[model samples]
Target: MAQLEQFTTPVDAVVSRMRALDAALPARDGVAVFNRVYLTVTEEVDRRVGTGGFPDPRTAITLDVLFAERYLTAVEADGPDRRPPACWRPLLQFRRHPGVRPLQFALAGINAHIGHDLALAVVDACRSLGCAPAELEDAYDRVGDLLVSLEERIREELMPGPDLLQIADPLTHLLGSWSLERARDAAWSAARALWALRGLPELTAEFTDRLDAAVGFAGRMLLTPLPD
Candidate 1:
């Protein structure tokens, strides 16, 4: 049906863009590192869209696409003249540091996307769907669960081996400090707050700006370069 196609096209298009990024960037590029992880998650979401993975397929597709576009837009808009969201600035600025590990890059990217972009994306999806944040909670949790499931696998694939990741290693401490579960939880709270403030444009803008800066600060800390 045309109505279904209308809802599905954006999801497919965003997945295509991510796949293209995966192909174009070198394996070691920090953005590329995050792209690979994101692409995998997006592909899984796509495959599960109509297969009962989502209680409401249409809402899932809308939220997923909106959530992914924020990151893709940051990638597209990065430059000296253009500022990506504050939360995204660190990863873009430090993408090529030799001392920063792939795991750091991936998590920093995750921090930015979930910490800042996700809350806004929920608002965006709610507006597009003519619903409220609470209405989208199911879809949000489903997507968050998918990310949580992939996170451990991400660590296993990208983390340095146990021998290198000693108890005293700074990387170990840094890794322990940030948790995806916490970020996802905070994002839900922020989304609720943003939705509540939607009627007050000035307050909404200020809260969003503060959220962006705070998330960016966390990302900068996550990207701290350690001696090799």
Candidate 2:
């Protein structure tokens, strides 16, 4: 129906932009690496939306687009006057470091997005849809589940071989210290808290700033360069 197509237009536009970025950047570039992972996830979400996988397709599409736009905005904020959010600064700054492995790049981006962007995206969706955070929970959980399912695949594809990944490997410890499951949990909590504070603009802004800084610190630690 025309209504369904109207709802999906934004999702398609975001997907097209991501695909363009995937083509534009080199495969090993840090932003490109995460962009590929995110593009695939977005495509999957789009497919599911068309197939009735989401009970509330409109909400799912809106959240997916809103969530992705945050990252795309960061990507475009390259000018001196357009700084990215604190949570995204680490990945953009260290994106070209020779000692930072591909897995680190991927996870660092994930941390910035899920830990920081997802919560804000939830609030964005609420405002757009004129609903509460609880109303968006099902769509949020579904999207989170898709990301969680892809995390293992990402690790398998990007992690170094066993010879380089010894039990004492710093990479092993670093990766183990940051779990996608936990990040997703925290984002959900933050989304609820943000929704509760929506009426208090000053407190909401302060809380959001702290969350951004904290997540950025974690991202910085995640991107620590290891010896090649």
Give the TM-score (vs. native) of candidate 2: 0.97
Colliding pairs, model 1: none
lDDT by residue (140-173, candidate 2, tens digit) is 9999999999999998888888778552289888
Model 1 lDDT-worst window of ten: 161-170
Among these predicted structures, which one has the highest TM-score? 2
RMSD of each: 1.5, 1.3
Q: Tell me the lDDT of candidate 1.
A: 0.92
> What is the C-alpha RMSD, rounded to one decimal, of candidate 2?
1.3
Q: After superposition, how far is residue 129 of candidate 2 from its true place, in Å?
A: 0.5
Give the CA lDDT, 0 to 100, for residue 222 in model 2: 93
